[model samples]
Target: MLHVISQDLSSFNTLGLRSNASALVRYEHAGQLPALSQLAQTYKKVFVLGGGSNVVLAPDLSALVVKVESRGVRLVAESSDAWLVEAQAGENWHEFVGSCVDKGWLGLENLALIPGTVGAAPVQNIGAYGVELEQRIQSVTAWNLQECRLVEMNAEACRFSYRDSFFKHEPMGRWLITAVRFRLPKAWKAVLGYPDLRQHAILAAAGENATARQVFDAVCEIRRRKLPDPAVLGNAGSFFKNPVVSPARYEALHKAHEQLVAYPQDNGDYKLAAGWLIDQAGWKGRRMGPVGVHDRQALVLVNHGGATAQDIAQLAQTIRVDVAARFDVVLEQEPVAIA
Candidate 1:
């Protein structure tokens, strides 16, 4: 096992917050799980770092950081209706989706260009363009640190909800996902029900006869245009989740604000557009010291430069408070803050 003391993690996270791990361990194979478990036992705190797209890191971590880097993809099973494909946790999510689309494995196209690794997808229940990762997931293989063994969990066992899953609720370093299996349907259908996707010029041009590739390209283009590139300007895509409200609450909010942007859920609840709320709350293009809300997309919070995790947290809290005061709705941040 390769270990580095006092490792800098500024480049590991998408937010680019200057942080350091007391010790960093490179996890490239399944054989390392046992050692990782031992190390986790040794350290009072331990963090499993994937692609680092959905995290806000503190200035210093007094913990052992395990960097998941296992990689591979293969068709594990096949049937007339669907194909079961397995991908190692370390694979870049966007590239994996692109490969599936290229091979005509149709389901992940709507989620193209999402930043992160395969392992982290299910944890966040990553979703976009009217579809969530749970819809495509067959099973998740993870190392259970407490038991010190590998285990496979089905979709139902995963307990997937909007932008959340069982993994998120588990104790830190308790479960480290190593691979994910996806069930891609052979009978594919376009999911352009999302307003942004449905109204996109590219998709509109494609019309009713839109192919999987077009949908993939459209999502990529839309994300590229709206989201800031973490490489150039650090950001963790949408900083806040679209708040889901009860039907009665939705009706009340809608009555008060005529221009409320929301979508109806099958469960009769309504998912309010957090971006619209933030914009209406007067936070778009606004800054707080080194961090600020992305001007183009109100949902995103960007790190201008030299911003710390505390800076991001303070700004997020300020926005949450302001939005709550104005709209009487609580906005929840999506990114996990690691101290």
Candidate 2:
């Protein structure tokens, strides 16, 4: 059975933008998805919502909003080499990570404190501290809206990339992720490549010997210092995706601006820091109406209070135009924009 409600979505989205959903449906089990899909057939448009941490809802959403709230986590399989952990779509990402670490599952330690749900992770290919969701993803179970059936997709089939997946592109709205399974290696090793994590590990005197719990704690601390809690201040965490450029382009930028922050990629491209670019454009801590760039981290855009979706869109566009003019690079927004 599907429970539909007409409600204001301001409380649902992290941005806290004023919006209204024509119809909203909440599902607590995978078995309900097929019926929900059938219910969606009655609507002109349908949109699936997760934890609402990575989206900008339009003021008037003339669509059926499906909120996934299915929840559970368990060890599905184990071998001599690895442990297969599975979690339902609606489980809180940070909580799930913490639970895994508590149980001695180590791979998700570096991704601690990331917002949103397990289902949304694969869609965004969420990453932090040199660890990405794709790295641990063994498989995904989803409801295929097009064929009106359930299907499973492996990591490679998801076409994981930098902040993107097949879920975000080709099959976009056709698949509703219900659960995700991760492969945690038995021989756990710390991912200390990220500077912040490395520094924290050193400061804590854990270094290479840091347990999964220590890494999780360090990540939480780092994130707490850098990002404002959405409950206290509205934000979508890293509004813009770091732009990747060719080695030649990076060299040219480096020559012009010696302090330009960038990281060398495995494929020879350079991932320029979007925050540095935004700060260079003089948008950090700057406010335009109800929207502003966060002072501590320029990559974040904050809602002062009572901001409209249009206001946020305008502010983002202005920043984009200015960054392009100054750096000849376009900064793409991380959150999905509903219109």
Candidate 3:
């Protein structure tokens, strides 16, 4: 069964911006997606919404907003080298990762506290603690809205790259991801190369032998200390993506600004820390009207209260302009601005 309601979306989005969708459709089962897609045809536009962690909606959405609420988690298969687990799109991401750790599954520990739903994970190729969702993803099951059929795509077919995927590019909005399948290694090896994780490993005395639970706890602790809780202060985590530049450009910038923070990629490119650039540009903790840059983490944009989407967008633009002027690097927003 599907329920349709006209509602305020301020409570849905993590940023707490006030917005109203013309009509919202809620579906709890993947089987309902086909009907939902058919219903969408009656509207001029349709928008798929998940946990609402990565979107900033306009003042009024004239389209039909489909809220995915399907939920389940189960082991699909076990091979000699790995375990295949599947989770519905609507499952809370952190909770799913925690469940994996509790069940002795190891690969998702590093992505502990990332905010969003499982289905939204592949759309952004969510990454943290040096481990990305793409690394553990085996396949994705989706409802092809365009063709009105169910479809499955292997990880490679997703074309994942640095916070991007085919779902976010060419095939955007044509498919609604119903669930994700992850391949967790049986011979679990901890990923501790990330700086904060390494430091926490030393503090916990786990080092290279850290259990998946320990790593998960450490990652959660680090995230808690750095990012503001949306419950306390409205925010979409890591508001901008780190800018990647050529090695020669990085070298030139390094010589000019000796303290430029960056990490070299395997392809010889360099990912400059967007937070460092924004902070250096003097945007950290700066506020205008009802929105501002987060005090603790410059990468976050916060809505103080009663702020509109335009207020947040303006603040972001100001910061981007300043960062570009200061560092000559362009910062790309991580959140999707729905208009």
Give lDDT tens digits, candidate 2, residues 195-293: 887778443587767878778888899999999999889999999999999999999999999999999999999999999999999999999999999
Q: What is the TM-score of each candidate against the true structure?
A: 0.98, 0.98, 0.98
Candidate 2 deviant stretches above 4 angstroms: 201-204
The lDDT for every candidate, in the order shown, is 0.93, 0.90, 0.89
Clashing pairs in 2: none
Sort the predicted structures by lDDT, highest score first: 1, 2, 3
Comparison by lDDT, 1 against 3, better one: 1
Model 3 root-mean-square deviation: 1.1
The worst-scoring run of ten residues by lDDT in candidate 3 lies at: 200-209
TM-score of 3: 0.98
Taking the tens digit of each residue's C-alpha lDDT, what string does model 3 give over 37-107? Answer: 78877877778888889998899999788888889999999999999999999999999999999998779
**Over the full model, what C-alpha lDDT does candidate 3 score relative to the true structure?**
0.89
